[model samples]
Target: MDLSSKSGGGRTGYNPVLIILGTVVVLVGGYLISLLSPSLFPLAASAEAGPIDQLFRVMLFLGGVVFVLVEGLIILSIVRFRARKGEAGDGANFNGNVTLEVIWTAIPAVVVVFITLYSYQVWVDIQAPKDDELVIETEGLRFVWSFSYTDPLNRLAEADTQNFTDSVLHTYVGRPVRLKMETRDVNHAFWVPTMRIKQDLLAGRQTEVAFTPTEAGRYRIVCTELCGGGHGAMYSYIQVYATEQEWMERFIDVRVERILNPPTDPLTVGFNLLNENAYPCSGCHVLESVNWAGVTGPTLNGIGDTAARRASANGLGGAEEYIAQAIRHPNAYIVPGYNSGVMPQFGAEQDEPDAVDGAYYVYMSDDSLTAIVTYLCLQTATGESACGDEAAIRAAVEAQ
Candidate 1:
């Protein structure tokens, strides 16, 4: 057994200079290998994407360097310090070196601090509010994302509401937009891969993200959080118009018309609400009248007739009471096959001290809740019971 720095074959243990050279070569070679595959990432569509991509590349380079160094040392030890053919009982044996331990530990600590500070700066830059930035309110629900657009300039002052639309997010190239996001049921992450922005939507509080689109095209808005059963279908879109004129013509004008000259009839208003996702109902229910194909909840094609029967059978007041109760307390009477705790309680208020079934949550206003129930009551497929007259619908709304 050779315990000294020399072996039986008269060979030197190892060369320090050669080991350093090999490490440098492996690191460089690994970096080159990553560069050869140029199509690893998707297209960058926002101004913040450039800096984020660069940061990712730097982190990747550092990771590759570490990988090469660790694996390289293992392979080098096996090849250079292995036992000779039936010649050695043991090779050199020594305790660990304090200097090498300190070197390895200090290197990682410094690298981590450096990366954290660098990434923090990028985050601050991206989040800083810009002058004249457009603000959009984004809501993440069970299986869809809804965006509300507020007009800052009052271009369409004649419109009754400040928000023209509440479903789709609209933006223009080179325009800085800030999203005020919230979740309805659970935690959700609003993610735009091309824009390189992702933020969480928490219940009972607001989170935000800001970005300036650099490209003029449509990009997908994905919910990166694992929210629920229908999380996979939770997606939306952002339309980046090429010019200000195009954006105004496509979005502003249409929004103004929608608010200023809304449908006067209740039927149209109800139908539009279900179809255009004014309340995110289309994502949970299936209604053929407005082409709503969501299957998360029960079908509403003949809910009017069913409401009256369910009311009578359950010893409720009437059809109006049943519909209203269904909206306010969704879990009160779950359908035969449907599960409870899925539908959101719309009329539950913060001040309402009484909690039902150990559940308390934010709910919708009386007016909005009534309107939705009125619309649902008008949906009668059989037409045998005369689908609650307009007076009954109005009375039900006023009863709330």
Candidate 2:
């Protein structure tokens, strides 16, 4: 039972070749795993995405190295240190190594500090304001997103109004964007997966997010937070144009021109208003004309004919009156299968006195409401308007 003779005369030796091979394996394995990052994420469409993705890859590499090292050691120990057939007692009895403990502790502490500094720098760089940043006013309602933009050049003082609003966030490559976001009914989140930017839209206060588009493509914008039953339908897009000239010519100039010379046709204006997501209808209804596929509310496939029947059944004056009432005061007559109070009240006034205390209220100008009604009234199988005329629609909306 001489222990020294069994332990090779008590001389402890290290395997240099094994150490070098293990280090090489750890480094190579980590690098190989990091190479899969591009496939793991959507296209890097923003300037911020580059650094963010790099940081992710760094962490991934470190994680892969640790994983390989730990699992490899575990497997090696299981095979190399298993008890022999005649072995019976405890394997090895020794005090813990303080040096080994210190090495493990110091390594993790250094890694943590490095990661903290690296992550903070990335955040600071991404959040820093850029020159000529386009400021967009973003509103996140229960199941929709609306983006508003003012003419950056201030060329149209005649149309000194709030400029224009659209459902899509439009910009050009290399242009920085700052989104000032607010929520109408509940908490929501504004997220652009390709841009790698997300910000919360609180109920009462406003929040903002910034990013610079580095690519020209349409990127999906989604509400990552579960705000309501229609959260899944809360999505839009960031339309990044290839050049500033293309953005101005295609989107900005077109929208501004529409504002400068307002369309006289109520149907065109109404279709434009709804198509641009002036209201949150797309999140709750299925209207094929505007490509709305919301499942929360009843479909509006043949709403013109449906409105005439509804008016007749409910003893309303006409289809125009019924449509007006449905838009302004939805709970007055609920569709048979749909629940009441789900749709927001589109009041004519900014602050309607008759609006329910806790209900969602959105302002709709008399003109816009009339035009919307007129447009919706044309959704019949016969391609004819169920409502009488423009004046009649306005009168009906006013009567509500």
Candidate 3:
């Protein structure tokens, strides 16, 4: 073998079939991963998801084919056209194949046209709103979310529109809901993992998005965009119901009935109040088990059990004094990462802990505060506060 003609002649030993097969294996492996990546694929679905999925599949197949064809030809030519042991001057120096060139150009143009048409359809189907769609307005802040329901009618009514500033809804589930989102402070994202829809709530601008939930459970509303010091805590939830009637029954009808036939457990009233309307605390804190979760404030979820890491960290004997003080004087020991001095004093409000503080703390009655506290402490992990994880609870106080 001469090995003189590197361009055209006896095989250069490059194997196109082997190259094509190896590439096919890798492409198939990647395609399989795409199909199984639920965490990424389950984001949100509308009519768009189906079309987008189809478009992606088609594109993937086309891309794989193109790769095989191009690489296969290169490898085949390198080996098949190379000069033999001692071949001629310039083997096969003929003109290019016009037919092959036309085939490649025409195929890509046709493929692009089809892609453009299919993508347009998907874009239209997802962006267009149906006439019967439910409309909601969302207000986002540092660590909390607010939702307002627009009346079914085209007319805007304050009475019908739940004033997020005054009374934001707990966000009923079910129905095809459309949302208009905005932010009060910084940039935030309105994301519901289950529904697979999340949109930016840009300050001073209204952003629009929509979703139709299929389940009757509550899902977290997380902020995909970083907004403030308490970014991690910037989450809320939206409850989805099996049907519209079920939604009303759980969020509205039941509340009225409970008000008429009040429960003996004060926590009942407190939690119901937390869900009834958007209270100020609903935006800045999280107190699960009693439905008092606001993103800006530290989560009060499971506060009923009572021991907290703070007292434990300081080696304090008990957590009650600190818990009470934290509420009454939130500024006294502001959580390290939080912005200081924004929380109003709840001291005067706690005077009558037996009362419910459903309204804003500044003007809420003592009964409201007590009821709020009573409801909030249920998730304390230690029957007093969420801050009291037994291990950390012990460590917190002992460390000090």
Pick the TM-score winner: 2
**After superposition, candidate 1 runs with Cα above 4 Å error:** 1-13, 16-21, 32-43, 75-92, 137-148, 153-167, 180-189, 200-207, 215-243, 283-324, 336-339, 348-386, 396-400
Q: Candidates' TM-scores? A: 0.72, 0.85, 0.57
Name the lDDT of candidate 1: 0.74
RMSD of 2: 3.9
Candidate 2 residue-wise lDDT, 296-359, digit = tens: 8889989999999999999999999999999988878989987665676788786654335334
Error of 3 at 379 (Å): 8.8
In model 3, the runs with Cα more than 4 Å from the true position are 1-40, 43-48, 55-121, 150-174, 255-268, 274-329, 335-370, 374-400
Cα lDDT tens digits for candidate 1, 182-202? 876689999999899999999
TM-score of predicted structure 1: 0.72
Question: How many Å off is the CA of 100 in candidate 3?
Answer: 13
lDDT of each: 0.74, 0.84, 0.57
Q: Model 2 off-target regions past 4 Å?
A: 1-14, 77-97, 184-186, 202-206, 313-315, 333-342, 351-358
**Which candidate ranks first by lDDT, i.e. highest?**
2
CA-RMSD of model 3 = 10.0
Ranking by TM-score: 2, 1, 3
Cα displacement (Å) at residue 136, model 1: 3.0
Model 3: how far is 74 from its true place, Å? 13
